[model samples]
Target: MQKLLKLILTSRVYEAAAETPLEEAAGLSRTLDNRVLLKREDLQPIFSFKLRGAYNKIAHLTEEERARGVIAASAGNHAQGVAFSARKLGIRSVIVMPLTTPQIKVGAVEGYGAEVILHGDNYSEAADHCQQMVETTGMTFIHPFDDDLVIAGQGTVADELLRQSAGQMDAVFVPVGGGGLAAGVAGYLKALCPEIRVVGVEPADSDAMARSLAAGRRIRLDSVGIFADGVAVREVGHLTFDLCRRYLDEIIRVDTDELCSAIRSIYQDTRSIVEPAGALGVAGLKKYVRERKVSGRTLVAVNSGANMNFERLRYVAERTLIGEKQEALFAVTIPENPGSLRRFCSDVLGDRNITEFNYRLAGRERAHIFVGISIRNTGERHAFGQLLGEHGFDNIDLTDNELAKTHVRYMVGGRSPEAGHEVLYRFWFPERSGALVRFLGSMGENWNISLFHYRSQGGDYGRVLIGLEIPPKEEDGFREFLDRLGYRFVEESGNPVYRLFL
Candidate 1:
């Protein structure tokens, strides 16, 4: 501990990395009812705190090692950090990245003038290839984390936090991936300011450190989810695991939805969009405060990086409302009659905006509607569900149902039929404004209209499946109505899957 503290005090990171601000997140503080400070490592030179350790590790290399140059295997912020640090120190650098790495990141490392080698399919394979190159090329390998100097450099962030907070903070939340940052920060905080509890946060799907500490021995995960890809490590580093087990107060695991909500919360507070891994600390902190019901105490969450992929923002946005309990999805059943839709809308929907509604008339008695609606806060979904029961409405909350969200919402058309003269037809309509309303207008009270499925696939045309009660007598008029509707239609009533399934 003393040696680590000494190394941190003298780390050479300031030559490249900035002393980022420790600003209070006023929005989070107010909402969580605690003083929440953000360690803005996301504002560092490489837009991540990684360069601190990368530079400090490479800066202290022996003259002989520096002459040999440097090499590393990474596809995220660590790759950029090592490349940037090596360039700053005028050393020849080579970065080995997975072939699956995004072009934006591959370009970022090359922009730093490092030789980028695209190899293998994932980090593990790329890392193995990097080791082979290290043996043949004799380049000094710069680890992203785990080395003592790297740990010491990351420890410097804790040093800054201690100084900025004046030992008044009750706890500090650190993000855990390969456990380097958590290990370093916890070591320093526990040694110098023992009263300030050091907590580590990791994704539930990739919690190597938390599981390791819990078992009193290292445990490697068989596989990990890619949602929080930045911190998706299957195993913790040897040195880092030891340090974390020794110093950390506790480790908290947060789900992907919680991470997304934390990302949104951080944006609301700081106008900064952080990567999923970067939001882990804030998510864990929120969970901690809620579960413990603590308030008014000073808390800190380290915002480790901001290297979010632009394309992933849409997915994050979609999940954020659900995570924050701002949107709730439900499977509801109501009477199947002409005035039922009108009464259901008037009684339940009222003036609230509906996000999505999928209704398929499969039975003569009850109609099932897959619906999404907005709510104000946590626990409101339960209240809303109870309200539905009060109105004699049978409904099942699907807000936290993973299968329902991922696939079931899109599969609302499959069911056994109870209506006679049902003609199943698959329809295609232009995925444009007012197209759906135009199609709906084609149906006239619709002779006990049976099935309807519509989901926009973000394409030129939206696909829909509708089963109408067109008896043999009105087949001619229904065919004329289909022509006026003008959307492409294919009769699927004879299809085997349709015949067997619905």
Candidate 2:
């Protein structure tokens, strides 16, 4: 610990990286009733703190090692970091990325003069191929995290935070992935100022570090959510895991909606659209404060990176309202008479703004409507439900329903009576031209596609809700087809929301 602290204090990262500012987030502070400080690592040369470790590691490489070149596998930020560092050092570099990586990230790595190779479907698969290349050709492999030097370099951010905040912080929140940043920040801060709490934040769907801490050892996830691709690591690194275990005060797991809310909060203060992983610290900070019911203390959130894809903003915008508890979704049943729709809108909804409304007449006497109404808080959702019930309206709150949020909301049409043997499934497929056609083609010609909903969110992958017609006799065949499909999917045919709406 002492050696690593020394290395962090004397890191040579400034040769290519900047001493980013620790700015106060006034908007978040006012909202949370706490002083929120943002470590602006997003302002670094590579728009990510990753360059700190990349440069520090590469600059210390032997001249002979530099000549042989460096290679790495990354889906985004780390790839750009290594590419930028290698270019500044005038060393040959190669970066292997998953085929599912967004083109914007691939282009950024190439723009930094690194040879970009697209391979596999995710970081784990690409990293496996990267190891193969390192064996065949004796190129130096620069791991994204886990190395002592890399951890030490990342720790520099902690040193800066302590110096900038004058050691007055109550807690420091960090995003956890392979655990480089969290391990580094927690180690330095805990060693120097034991009074300050060090919190690690991870996506709930991809919480390798949190799971590892609970189990007292590293645990590998079978699959991880890719929404926050930057921190979507399946396993925590060994060294990083050890450091985090020793130094971190606690770990917080947040969902995608919470991440989106944090991103929106950052934008309100900094006027910058941070990527999902970059906003994780803020998300954790919010969750912690609300859960612990503590406030007025100075807290810091590391704005880790800002390599956002422009096209992804659409999806982020859609989710931000829900994340902020400003949007409520519900399924309401009302009379199909001409005056019923008017009465429901004028009396039940009152003057509330409707964000979305989907309805298709299914019965002669009654009609089901999927509606999104703006609300001030979570409590108001229940109040609105009570108002509907008083007006003889049968309503179901779909605000927290996964099936409704992901599929049924978009697939809101009455269920098809002729749609026999229908099996609904939600799938995630690589986004590119012909990807949808390819997915449809993979399914045989016998089965019919009863219902399909797909909208491109400009992320690395496309989400699809598919309802396929397969008789009981072909259920086994359908399972075989899904096994061969090679895409992550979940069966939603039996979902109550699906049965209710479509």
Candidate 2 steric clashes: 0
Per-residue error for 463 in candidate 2, Å, reads: 0.4
Top lDDT: which candidate number? Answer: 2
RMSD of each: 11.3, 1.4
Q: State how far residue 263 of model 1 sits from its true place (Å).
A: 1.0
TM accuracy, model 2 = 0.97
Quote the lDDT for 103 in model 1. Answer: 79
- Model 1: colliding residue pairs: none
Off by over 4 Å in 1: 363-365, 407-502
Query: Number of clashing residue pairs in every model?
Result: 0, 0
The total number of steric clashes, by the backbone 3 Å criterion, in model 1 comes to: 0
